[model samples]
Target: MALHNKIGVLGEEIAVRYLKKEGYYIVERNYRNKFGEIDIIAAKESYTIFVEVKSRSSENYIELAQSLYHKQLHNIRQAAIFYFSEKNIHLSSIRFDLIALKIDPDAKKIDKLKHFTNIIN
Candidate 1:
């Protein structure tokens, strides 16, 4: 895999580990269709979550909030709809989450992880 793709995979792994630690039951990962892709799917309490993961190497400097684009958010929503329809899941509460990772280049370890929940309605 390309270095960027590898970083992404690592970031998703880290995100999943963090979510599990926070008591979220992992439902799926890399859920995708023609619409788009969801990096992770997890559940906590009454809320089912759709997660998007973004990772940056130590050499890269960018704000987490600015890293995500409007179109990416749009596609995530579309994928969430497709996931629910296909899986026949109907929940009263749904949430969108974004996990941003800062990885150390030399060790390839996650230096930090920032999780933003309920990004969209």
Candidate 2:
């Protein structure tokens, strides 16, 4: 894999570890549709979460933070809708989450990580 792809894989791994530690059951990873991609999908309580993860080693965290915008949000929502319909999942609630990560590539350590929940609704 390319360096950027490696960074994303590491980041997603970190995100999954954090979520599982926090009591969320992972439902899927790298869910894609015609709309967009959801990096992680998890279930907790009655909530089904669609997560978007932004990972980078060279870029500033703030810049990575700004990378997700309205278009992407819309696409994610559309994809989530498709997922629920396709999977026949009938959850009480649906939510969107953002997991931003900045890693030390050489050390394979995360320097900073933030999880923002209910990003869409």
Please provide, for model 1 over 29-107, each residue's C-alpha lDDT reduced to its tens digit, 9 standing for 90 to 100. Answer: 9998988989999999999999988888853325776777899889899888888889887854899988889987569
Top candidate when judged by TM-score against the true structure: 2
Model 2 Cα lDDT, one tens digit per residue, 27-67: 99999888878899999998889989999887776787679
Global lDDT of each candidate? 0.86, 0.89
Worst 10 residues of 1 by lDDT: 58-67
What lDDT is obtained when candidate 2 is compared to the true structure?
0.89
Which residue pairs in candidate 1 have backbone atoms (N, alpha carbon, C) closer than 3 angstroms, thus clashing? Answer: none
Q: What is the TM-score of each candidate against the true structure?
A: 0.91, 0.93
